[model samples]
Target: MTTSSGSSSHVTDARGPLHTGPGDQHIYYGDIRASASSDRSGRDPRQVAVEELRALRRRFVDPVGSDRARELLEDKRAVMLTAGRGHGARTAAKVFLCQLPQGSRRFRELVDQAEEGDSAGRALDREQVERGAALLLDLSTVSSRRYETFMAELPWFLKVVRECDAWLAVVLPALWRAGFEHVFRGLVVRLERPDPAAVLQAHLRDVGIHVRRAEVAVPELEHELTTATMAQTADLSEDIRAARENAPPGSGFAAWLKTALAARAPGAQDVEAHLSGLDSGAQRALLLTTALLHGARTDTVHEAAARLARAAELPEVATPLLHHRTLTARLAEIKAAAHRGRVRFTVAGYDAGVRRWFWDNYPQLRGPLADWLRTAPGFTALERADRLELVTRFAHERLRTGPPDGLAALAERWSGPSASPEELTMAARALGEGVVHARYGSHFRQQLYRWAQDTALPGHRAHVVIGVCSEVLSRRFPDQAMIRLRHVSRHREQGVRVTAREALARITDSDDRLYRSLLKRLAPGEEPRGLRDLGIFLHVADPARMAGDATVGALLADHWTAALAHLPPRRWEQPLRAWLERAHTRPVARRPALRALATACARQRAAFGAVYAAACSWAAGDPARRRTVNALWEAAGSVPRPQPSRTAAAAR
Candidate 1:
């Protein structure tokens, strides 16, 4: 149960061309079906989110204004929550959205205009506000100008929300509350900071720590609680949990609390003190290695430390390995220890502290550190989990201290042409960390977008990007994931293209809105890429994959009309045959499929002639096949044709 980052942009309604190239015809329907089935067998993202939300709910303490906020959300379907920083406003917003009965509706965080690309100036796209959706629009980080733009569009956005019967919870910046109070008089709910001790207690209890209230109400703890943010309190509980786990047998809660509190003390001074005691570059490199791979086997950590030292060009002593200090002595010097073959810091949170100290104090070493991480995880003695954990730790520290470019560059390097399996996994893990980072996710998403569009992207890099887009980004940012997948589906590499298409098909098959959205984006037009677009369209548009609802019927009709008018019969004939086969086998899909085809034909007589010719061709031989085609054709012709209005005619 992990938290996702904020400040993502909304997906635009602009329909883009999906052009798979000349060999797209090779992407058979069977390939798509196999890919979709495989994808379904994997973990579902929605379930993961729900479980995370449930975990958060276990630790949530209602703030002072939460009751009123809930009332506003329930009665009016939208609420603007205002609280100063560190009041857990974002957490509260998620909790509020989670309170809504999920049903089939999605719980999504909307990207604001500030983050949205070309559509930044427009109101929220009405199409994205699906009915019964529980939405969160976080404006806490937007500029005043962007906030004002959003305010100007609030009326239209609210109109769409109401029309769709959706719920929205907006977390507003407290600084601008006074400025916009008049505009949103009834819609705003000003929240007071909740009791920090209560938050701590809830978190502790959530981790199975139960104690009397009086036991935790001591003055030393009280002072810290008074000053600590809700997030800090939660961290305190986590530290306490860790401390308890590491404490000697028979250690009590009081002992654990004391240790946890000390760990929370200003860590920079402690880290600086420990570094001052280390006498050599080798020792310092070992400390950094242990910090990054905190719990790896002592031997693995030693090898990684040696690798880091060499990569950073740290001069080693001329003394022989046996003549130099032992690994045990070095570990003691760094205030770390090895127990049961694994190494970790003596202090509960000291590893993270050491990581921060190095990342902050010596910015020059950042490049060397990144380089070391690229290859250090490939130690033969390191297990898969150890390698991935090392990459994860490095990604966290790098993203925390610098711009995302460094991490993004490392991902590319690791996934380059000569990358090993371990290097590729490192690349995937690093990019995944960036995707889920609270501050830098949007930056990483942009990187993914660029990589998806790179024609010369190596197959390995393409593979990593596709995996992250499908497994990582798709969970929290499905729309962005879909956009990237669509781009990758057009890659020059055939296997990459097929994998991308499979991800697209799997995603759309499970969500009808996305299916329609994909259709609109791939809709045929005057674009010269009609052949490829039609191929992709036919691949995902299996009649057996869609529900027999009127909405799906209408979307199919509209797209079929454009595809029929623009594409040659040969480009779509196989898919048409597939759909006809489904209509013949599945009673429920028969009428809707035929009627959609008929509607397309009625809208374009040339399309009707094409369909007639294809059907006649298919009916040429077998008696059973002829009977099915004749019955489908007769039924399709009987369906009513929509009349073109005079206004439509004049506009055309």
Candidate 2:
């Protein structure tokens, strides 16, 4: 920097004349590969000059008394980073460090003006600012003293920590370990003390970044959580999980329910009510998404999509409210479109499914349906339906190639009242044998068994299912008949063979195919008997298994007295008693005959209570039984009980 001061600060071309280079310039260190483009001249320097001065002060100033010197270096670093490059970078830098007398307003003005000039984009250039910003970090790094000063100037220095990935080999460790505390805690610690490498190693250990002591390997982890969950980290899934789990008691997601309730959340009983009640598909979609953020499941989103899909296929939904009946009035329009191969177009506003339903049923919609199918988007989407329908249709077509499954037994389920027991038995056996080789599903077999439990009568409509060779399974195995009559009489008696459940247990359980096929032919509500009944009939055939009538005290209502007279006192005792006690007890109590039947051989206790209740009541009528009855009665306050003897005494 000195032009003539030879003794103190000399600039007199003092390089050792290595054979006297041609010009005044000789390679200073034998390293003249290229001249630095940033070689400075006398141009108006940027406010970054202060940055250079600060760096100079830090390098030359005494370490023990260098507080302001460090602060100036920090401000300079911020300038070089945020400001742009310019001429006179070196000389302006040296001039900035020139010592000045105290009480001088001019020096302070220069500092403030330089900062304001950099702020105004007049000195610190934009591109240079960004390049300089690359060096920013809270912890020390491997860089020149000047570059370190540049990094110190940034305000929100940690922003670079997140947005800049390449810097993580050093800075991220500091940020992670101490949460940026290293900058303040390590303030008094001079850069020469611990040094960059030592600072980095210690930071890595403190932050738990798992760095090898000397290795420079950088690791990038995958982000498991969404952006909303990430504050400043890519692999913070563990942190998020912990936070969610230990949310403050009485104040986390559980408490959200109370908050939602306090606000009178719509349909607290049914979360989906908002989505379901919406007439518009778009509105429902909005609600569905909101519910998701509120912790609704993915299935709820899928369901909303499906609802819109189905609604879009309905005429009532697809048509504008004002134009709902337009399809009917535009009959000629429909015909013209059909003539032009545009039938589908005429039905454009109507839901294709609704049109098809009308055409398939009322015949009037046939015209519209045909016209629409020719041109509407319905046929376009129908191509996709082809794949779904293929398997079902294949199963149906295969069925027709052979005999119908379980036709014989299934025929009995659909038989008329005139069908004789022999005819029914033959039909049932044939149907049973037919299904032995059929590919009947378990669900179908269960249904068939249920049907077997029911008796179909003549002149009554009983729905039967038929397989189609055309449509898919849904349509192929169509439920036939408008109604299925379920007469309880056919299955009333136990026999050698019966419904699937009542069939041989060990035998049927092993033959899953037979069990399932049989179930399919059965109607709902009628169920199979258990393994016990089946075992008794197949393995033992005990008389007890075949036994019917259960004993009960006889009771003749006056309404059926004439019919009752025809019986020999035991015709109705069995089932009526079985039904009264739910067939639970062995023998229905005699109810002490309301005086031992000495007065009227009738159900005298019936006047006051049911068979069990009356019998119990009658027992209670005895002084001996009353004690037990009273004890029980007092224990179960207001409990209801009936004792026949007691009732009879009261009646008397």
Candidate 3:
């Protein structure tokens, strides 16, 4: 059953301060302060991944075949983990990679091979497989066609992994094992589910809950352990932790256990029973509104409930206000409580249960609910936190149910030309939730790709798409993020293109590989777009950011060669002079910067002449600057220029 103790409780609300945990950092649009952390200065995604790995390590219990998998991985540098769904194969793969010795190597989950029929062959570029890198290729969700394509390329991929001395753990789909079993006989490790009791115990202890074996040996707990998957067991442990924290100060473990158990399996039944007694349309509207905005202020909930009633075409009662039951009494009848000013269900996680029951049992109401949510954020006095919470709740339900297009349609509507700034923010946040979802992330990526390539996309919608790319997708999927941003950078709207360019520059500058990737993508263009690319190149090519690394120096030289070949001296003179000025001032950057510039000019006489002219003008007055220029010119002259190409000679 769906419960609030699932990932939903990790969502921050207006009732409390936001906790900046590892899980919290990836949420792009929850709190304003949290949102600020998603900018250029945000925590590195690699570091965040490592922190999550560490957190996983704390709660992870080794499934059966883990040792064999590790042995195979160490011996072959690649191991295929095969297990049925809910057996923790993905987690086991990650844990295997995490157990490797820490070093300068990269650790990341590689995106799947592109879908069938695409000429790209495999999405895993050769440049991505660096030496000593630890990679995970989770193909559990691939379609049959994609899986066949992956199998065709698996041999070459493994060969590359071996050549690079890297480690790889592939989580294969269980259904396809027989088809490829003979081919990868020795490489496959069939993993079995770990003991549910042990999994639950580890999760509980990881969260600082101490319980004895005897304390957890109840009949109900035993039945759950026997029947539940590893994921559900972990969810039960989380529910217990949430229940304990929300329990009264002096409540014992028994009380928390009872509350958690009731919330875990029977929460939907509880909601169904509660809703059956409520006959009035207004009462039902208020109940559903409270579920969506559980921690909102009571006044906010009241106003939103009325709005929802109107949207659903629920008839207004003719009873006088004095004769009607008060809001507090109605709330009591619906099993919700108003504490101080905030509203929530009296039973923990019951709000989530209520939401699930309504969405699952009444399919027709989904349209009215979507329409109501479109204006609920605006008409109600929702704080930023409340608005974020509303969007997240709505997104979670939509993604969990069928037809994911409802959330997409609502987000697009909110991002229309006439939508307000608040509506736009809500739209972005709603899509952000989808981008970070475990199951529907690929769907949202495809959706954003379509939006990015649309010629008629509105400026406001472009802004929302760019915000999701920079803020949400960039954290875990930098490659996809860069691709989308580059597409948006070519948009007709100047402001949208500029914002996309800035985001691209910031994201690439933070990592060497990404920087090189962007340079390669932008270095081959011609004319007007070439000019824009040059501007982005200059913005990210600061020597201070490079830290004078030799590899960065080489990349800088290559980019300069492209720039020199395409643009006139006037187009690049200022940034070239700025580099020379920095060389004159900073001793550490002098050698690498000068060498890169000289190397860029080594092959063309005209390029050499442009650098020589720029340097002479830049150092006209200062003696030291003059000496640096002289040295740069000498280096350029030492490298002999190549003979002109046949095309160039014929043109001349």
| TM-score of each candidate structure, all chains considered together | 0.79, 0.17, 0.82
Of the candidates shown, which would achieve the greatest TM-score relative to the real structure?
3
Using lDDT as the measure, what is the rank order of every candidate, best first? 1, 3, 2
- TM-score, cand. 1 vs. native: 0.79
Of models 1 and 3, which has the larger TM-score? 3
Candidate 3 lDDT over 554-612, as tens digits, reads 56776677678887777678778777876677676777778777877875557787779
Superior candidate under TM-score, 1 versus 2: 1
Those runs of model 3 whose alpha carbons end farther than 4 Å from true positions after fitting are 1-42, 101-105, 112-132, 204-224, 236-266, 454-456, 544-551, 568-590, 603-652
Each prediction's RMSD to truth: 7.0, 41.7, 8.3
What TM-score does structure 3 among the candidates reach? 0.82
Every candidate's lDDT: 0.72, 0.25, 0.72
lDDT of 3 at 641: 59
Spell out the clash pairs found in candidate 1: none
Candidate number with the higher TM-score (2 or 3):
3
Instruction: For residue 415, give model 1's deviation from the true position in Å.
Output: 3.9
1-652: candidate 2 lDDT, tens digit per residue: 1121111111222211111001122112111101110212421111232333443333231322234423543443211111111111222223222332110101111111122223342211222111112222222211233233333433244344334321111121111222323453332222111122222333333334334433422221211111121111211322323444445765542233233222221222233332245565434332322221122223332333344334434322455668643422332322212233222222221222222222233343223322221221122222222211221222233233333433332344433455433223222222222322223332233334345335431211111211110011111111110011111113333221222112122122222221222222222111232222222212211111111211111111211121122332332233232222321221222222121221122323232222234335434466655443343233333323322221100000
- Mind giving the per-residue lDDT tens digits that candidate 1 earns over 1-652? 1111121112212221233323443323222222211133455443444566777778889999999999988988999998988898888988888877752225777764323344346536675686677888877866677677778777778878988888888888867645553547798888899888888889899989986788789888998898788888898999899999989999988898999888877489988987898879999999998998899998899998999899889886788767988899899988899999999988767888888899899898998888787676467489866777777777778877658899888888888888776677777778877886666776778788888877669877887887777767776677777778777776777777767776676655444455555665664454634444555666676554344344456667766776787777886676677667666666666667777788777877767767877876766787877777777678667766664211111000
Worst 10-residue lDDT window for candidate 3 reads 1-10
Quote the lDDT for 563 in model 1.
Answer: 71
